[model samples]
Target: MSVDHATMSGLLAGLRVVDLSRNLPGPFCTRMLADLGASIIKVEPPEGDPSRPLGPLFDALNHGKESRRIDFRQPTDLDQLREWLVDADIMVDSFRPGILQSMGLDFDRLKAINPKLVMVSITGYGQHGAWSQRAGHDLNFMAMSGALDQMRAPTGELAMSNVQWGDMAGGSSMACIAILAGIFDAQRRGTGRHIDISMAHGAHAHLVLPKATATLFAPVLGHPPGAGEDMLNGNLPCYNLYATADGRHLAVGAFEFKFWKAACAVFERPDWVERHWQRGQAPGSPENNALRDDVAALIATQPLAYWAERFEPADACVTPVLTMHEAQAHPLFADAARTQPWAAI
Candidate 1:
């Protein structure tokens, strides 16, 4: 039997999710589920979600979902919530480790009521970790995961991005994966599961490639790369950002030999064609640093418009850095504007 409800027809059409989470992570997860046609019941306290004051953000995250106001202090309200859970396929929450247990909404108790409920708890740390009960946010999670340390400029200055990597990628996206996997398993075995998602742990998992590179090449390199010293980060001349004459930036991603060759042709520096990683050139070496300086100096001779026009038809893997407004109006994002309703927000 299809778990889909008759009114909808997406992948999660008939799934019912009870979202007792407020801020970003839990709400964003449920929002993605709702987009796939799941019915989301956003359970909020009488005071409402803390994000409610953030008008556009709140609308973007909670749109198309039913809102239910419940004060756990009231026995009737709590009982009503339990009644809702009886028919819920999934329950998502983002409280500290033992907050749900104190409110009598623990997984053990809820699982008895709804034997097929897939319960998911999201936190900055795992449920049983020493820092599980600690109060922290996305930045703290990124810092703890070592991912933030990698976000550095060529000058070794740490750069803070507006993108909440920990909240969205680690917490929201991981919770969605856990929910779907749990649902599949429960349908097969007729038993529910509790998923513990740590945002910091998920963020750390994204460092797999960098971690492997650091470990595998430590013997040859004498030491692991730090901050912007890694190949993909900013150490390589073939793949780095450069400033143009107008102070605008251009992203040069000519990592492969062919792309580097093409970029060198565009730069009118055919001599730089052989000074690439494929030709036994070590990144961050004295020769490579000199090559980077030469490349930067050449790029600085032209404005962003001139280089953008030059690279528009070349297979050099180079592009002008664009502002958010420019990106939104770009042709590449045309389909996004039509399909993603929240793209405007």
Candidate 2:
């Protein structure tokens, strides 16, 4: 892909960022900063960032920035890095705790060199914790945080996700938000602060919403429904995926009464409307499974395109389950695709 650096513009136009991170999370965070017009100087090790060999993804994340390959382990290289940090506004790294400190790039050391530098350290656990020293990745973090348990399939196997929740949402997104906040705080206080980000902690934080609901319903429900046994996880007829006659799937998000009623009307199954969440009709219950089977059978009578057209004017929350290619080609994403951060790259 061709990069048009001039097209990058944002509020952080004059901000200077020194990226000492590699792989997905740190690079993703720095990319966001670069997109917002920060002057990102991506300092690569002598061997270069690992993502450099990842082809299109490398261009997608590291484009629109200045890259310098330096081996900080060498004395002269370390001196050069110190030069880069002397006036840098922000510094981000993804090494485990104490690693950077050993390299003399710790917060206090960097702060002494540049008082206004916002230093962000992204890790798997945190700076000081029992699990901080352990090695982990996105799957490990998600699994340890119980998020993976909630994503189990009908056969009790964990479903692989298309996106890395721990890396992207937990590490990258959290780091981006903290870096921005750190920048504000540094300017206001005339000093910078160290931002410690734990990918596992961030992943666990996302469980707040559904966890609260599960806690609230636990006493009455015996236990919150287990994975695919829950309403929102495909056990309920109103909120699930259905296979069409053409072997394509459709997503049904009619959890609310109005939408569920509309869907029932469309299926000529008005009797199933009021049966929603009735006694003995809890998700995965015999009654619920029977209703799900009935609904699935009805859905299988028509092809995906037929259902798509039939529900076009209906208020039912029904839509086709599109493939990634189809989604990118769809009109709904035309504007987003055109304005995406990687568009110019």
lDDT of 2 by residue, 92-117 (tens): 99898998888888888888889998
RMSD of 2: 4.0
lDDT tens digits by residue: candidate 1, 39-73:
99999999999999999999999997999999978
Compute the lDDT for candidate 2.
Answer: 0.85
Count backbone clashes in candidate 2.
0
Which residue pairs collide in model 2, if any? Answer: none
Q: Which ten residues in a row have the lowest lDDT in candidate 2?
A: 335-344
TM-scores for all candidates? 0.92, 0.89
Judged by TM-score, which candidate is best?
A: 1
Highest-scoring model, lDDT: 1
**RMSD (CA, angstroms), candidate 1:** 4.2
